[model samples]
Target: MKALFIPGNSPYPIFSHAPLATAVRNAGHQVLMGGIEWVLPNIASVGLPPVKISPVSMEEVGAFMGAMPEDPLDQLKAVGRVYAEIALDSLERLLDLADHWRPDLVVGGGMFYTAPLLAHQLSIPSVRLEWDRIDARMYDPGAESVLAPLLAELGLDRVPEPDLWLDVCPPSLRPADPVPARTMRWIPGNPQRPLEPWMYTKGDRPRVYITAGTRLFSGDALRDMARSIAGLGVEVVVGAPENVAAELRDQLPDVRIGWVPLDVLAPTCDVIMHHGGGGTDMTALNAGVPQLVAHPEYPTEATRRITEFGAALLVDSGGQEAVTEACRKLLDDSSYRERARSLAREFTELPPPAEIVADLEQLVAARA
Candidate 1:
């Protein structure tokens, strides 16, 4: 069978889709990926399967970003609008690919609005692969207000729901509002690279892993947060790009700095600190490591659920003092570690991606 995987025009969504695509391919199905050009390099970097780039340009993405309003609600609406626009822009290429490839199934990233529409047009079954629980809101009440015009252009009345929704988030970390979802074991799909010898070695002091994610980039606030964490008398390792690491190096002369995949780094650390990205949160959960999330703007559902589960602490401002205090709690408290291990046990009990492949095959066959 041929499966078309549509990833969002961002690294996170692409990363989320990789392991599942691997599973499908291993089950003797052909997998074809689709997305914008900017994310293609990152997808290749992570060693995802070959992709067919959409006609959407970087300039279009830039314009979408620039047009975002200051209000959070407005920002969300704008994002929805852009998602629709990208879907519209790529409609022709995607349709052409579908005609040639004749895929039996479509697995789409939650935010890649084009996938479901195309699948509906072709009368093929589609499924959703979500990065986190926030995807539950994709079809919420006001979604039509943002998506209707685009759907209308395609002669679609509404964004058709996928035949299945793949839930990677652990039950303990899922959102309150329930949706039609099937739980799939969470697999850490961060890009792999050569690991340094020191990464495996235990240090004299407690170790802490800090990252603001790739999108946070660099700023005085982030640098100060790193500096303060480095000063906390613990062994500090900062995961960032070379340029960001260089900037942090000026402030933190003795801290370890480099781009190490979270899957490799999480097991070695006592506490994990990050920007509350779903990938980072799930990685920490899988590693059975406690977390300190410094998410000022968008505190994800995973952040809230993890904190409520007693495995993580949230720091809203990304302030030095707040993060330091949270890190201290994570290291000094035994309950945090205990809860994290419990969560990890729950995660392990879910069916692995390889096992889920059979289920997906059955679903496709039934639909076909």
Candidate 2:
């Protein structure tokens, strides 16, 4: 079978969809990925096969982000508008690509509007790989006005729903939202990199992994958090780019620093601290490590869910004292670790991505 995977024009979505593409390929299906040019490198970095879609300029995305309203619901609406605009911009090119490729099925990340649009045009089944809790605000009635022109152009009165929704969040961690979904095991898609010797070595003290993801690096705050945590008589490992690591080394001479893959470093950690990205949060859960998330911006659903599950703590104030206190609780409390392990077990017991290949095939056959 030929499968086309469409990731949104963002690094997060591209990385998130990589594992599913790999699973499909491993199941003896041909998989091809589509996204804007900017995110194609990230897809290729993970060694996934990709076919470039119509490019959306960075300036356009940047302007949309910059112009987003302060209210969270408003922000989601703004994002929906941007996605609709990008989808409209790329519609013709995407149609042409689909005509040439003639894929049996279409798969896309949850926020990627183009995949469903293209699939609707081709009259083929499409699946949305859930990235986080489905925000109803993103699908607000107001978005109809913002998207009406494009929807009219495509002969669609509204955005068509995907045939399937693939969710990776464990049942206990999922929100009470009513979206019917098929649960897939959370597989960390952090890019594969060389492992450092220290990653495998057990330290004398509890190990803590600290990261702020590739984007949204908190410069001084992260250094301060690392410094405070280092003084707690624990081993501090900072995952960052080489230049950032060098800068952090100046602030934390005793801390280990480098770009170690989260999949390798997470298992060694007793506690993980990060900026509350969905990918990082899921990685910590998969590793059975308790988390301390400091998100001054909108806290992701994963952050909230993990906290609700008692496996993690959220620090929204963005203060050093809050971060320090949360780290202390994560280190000193045994309940957090126990809950984390329980969540990890739940994730482990779910059917692996490869196991879902037959289900996807059935869905496609039914569509045919």
Candidate 3:
């Protein structure tokens, strides 16, 4: 079997999709990753007028998006427009790949909405992976009005045949309400690292892991976040390029810091400061390190569950005092560690992602 994947712009998909990709290859299916460059032609599906805000400039993008009603219905209109933009910009290239790869199935993460169309065009079954359950009404406030209709239009109205859906989410993270009579399988890979290997120590200096920097990161706010950690006698590890690091370094010379791999450094740190992307959340939690998330616009279901599971602290991109205080609370109190550990216990108990991918292959085959 030959399998192809459609990826998105964010870094999270690379990690989330890795286990499944490897599993497919190991099981004798050739896997090819279709980078988002193919998504260009389909960008039209996301109408530009509704997607008034631009991805190029993050500062202007948020304020512009904010002006639109925060209601889910309005958000839906905006997201639809944005998705269409992505489709118009990338779809042609997506279909063209089929001519060569001749994949048996096209699997996609929902972030790139055009995958369904690509599957239809090529006359192949499309498998969509969801990190979290999709419940229209259960979203943060104004979600249902917009999300429900979109899913329906996408053919989610019917239970996918032979349980084609692979939802890695466990019962604890899933909403109270579920799609009735739909048999969903849990294929888990979001793995965990034991704390025995990674212990948290305050030492004479505090160690803080800042995941996302101001590339519209609330630049001053993130700088303030660094400052707050420094003031508290803590060391900061900011993961950014040389220029940004150089700039920030000029501002704070003495606080211990460097740009290192998340896998290596996150385990050594006491707490992680990030913008709540899924990979970072999973990595930090699995390492038994608590989180401080600066909530961003339009966080997906995965982001919502991370906070609900008590693995992280939600801090708005506001004043430094507030950001500093949240960091203090997480570092000073032991309760945050307990919550992260609790979630980690559950995250690890399920079957790893490799097994899940193999199960998905079986499911797809059964249907065929």
Candidate 4:
């Protein structure tokens, strides 16, 4: 069987889908991942062969994010429309590839709107892989609004749902209202660097790993938080791109700053402080490390759940002080680590990615 994986034009979406793509390929199925030029390197880095679709520039994605409203629901709606636009922009090239490639199944990241539309057009089964524990179906109404005209042109009323949903969120941390989904264990797909002894092994003092995610952060705020956290007698490690790491290193001489792999460093840490990106959040969750999220955006279902579950803390309003305080609380409290470890256990117990390859094959066969 041949499977086509479509990731949104960014690194994180591709990171979430890499484990499953690799799984399907290992199971002797042909796999191909498609995206704009920007994400081709990312796809290649994850050991998947990349097929270039149409272009959606980073500037466009930045503009869409910049235009998002303050309200969470409004933001969700806006994101939905933005992705719908991405689908429309890329669908022509995608269809052209589908005609040539003729994949038996389409596997897509949650926000890759092209997945369902392509599957629908080709009459193939589509599988949607959720990055974390949020209600992805919330984007449907907004997506449908933008896609309505396009659907009419195609002689369809609505975009069809994927035949399957692979949920990576642990059962305990799942949102109260979740779309019907099959559970899959979360796997860390972070990019790797040469491992140092300290990265894989724990030190004597409490270790805190801080990252700003792939995009968007305040250097001054991160520097302050790292310095302040260090003052409390804990080891602080910051993972970032080289340019940012150079800047951060100039500001803080004592802390470790570089591109440290989260999968290797996470287990050695007592706490992880990051911007509330889903990939980073899940990576920490998988490591069973308590979290301190200091993003400006309002809490989503995943963040709210972990915070409520006592495995993490949120710093929405306060600047560095609030973040430092949250980090302190997470580090000082034993309960937080206990809860995080418990959730990690739950996450590990869910089905592995390889188990789903057979299921996907069955879905394709059933359709035939």
Error of 2 at 312 (Å): 0.8
State the lDDT of candidate 1 residue by residue for 226-300, as single tens digits: 677767788888888787777677777787887888887788899998876677878888989998877534655
Residue-level lDDT tens digits of model 2 in 300-345: 5656667888998988765677777889989999999999999899
lDDT digits (tens) for residues 1-368 of candidate 4: 99999967688888888989999999988999998877888899999999888666677767767777878888878888877888888888888887788999998888778898899889999999987765666787778888888899988888778899888888887767777888898789877767789889889999988886533354776677778889879999988778778888878888899888888888899998887877778888899999888773656777888899999988877666667778888877899999999988998799999998888999999999
RMSD (CA, Å), each prediction: 2.5, 2.5, 7.8, 2.0
Task: Please identify which of the two predictions, 1 or 4, would achieve the higher TM-score against the true structure.
Answer: 4
Top model number, lDDT: 4
Model 4, TM vs. native: 0.94
- Candidate 3's displacement at residue 299, Å, is 6.5
Better of 2 and 3 by TM-score: 2
- Arranged by lDDT, best first: 4, 2, 1, 3
**Model with the higher lDDT, candidate 3 or 4:** 4
Candidate 3, residue 133: Cα displacement in angstroms equals 8.4
Query: What C-alpha lDDT, on a 0 to 100 scale, does residue 262 get in candidate 3?
Result: 69
Please give the lDDT score at residue 241 for candidate 4.
74
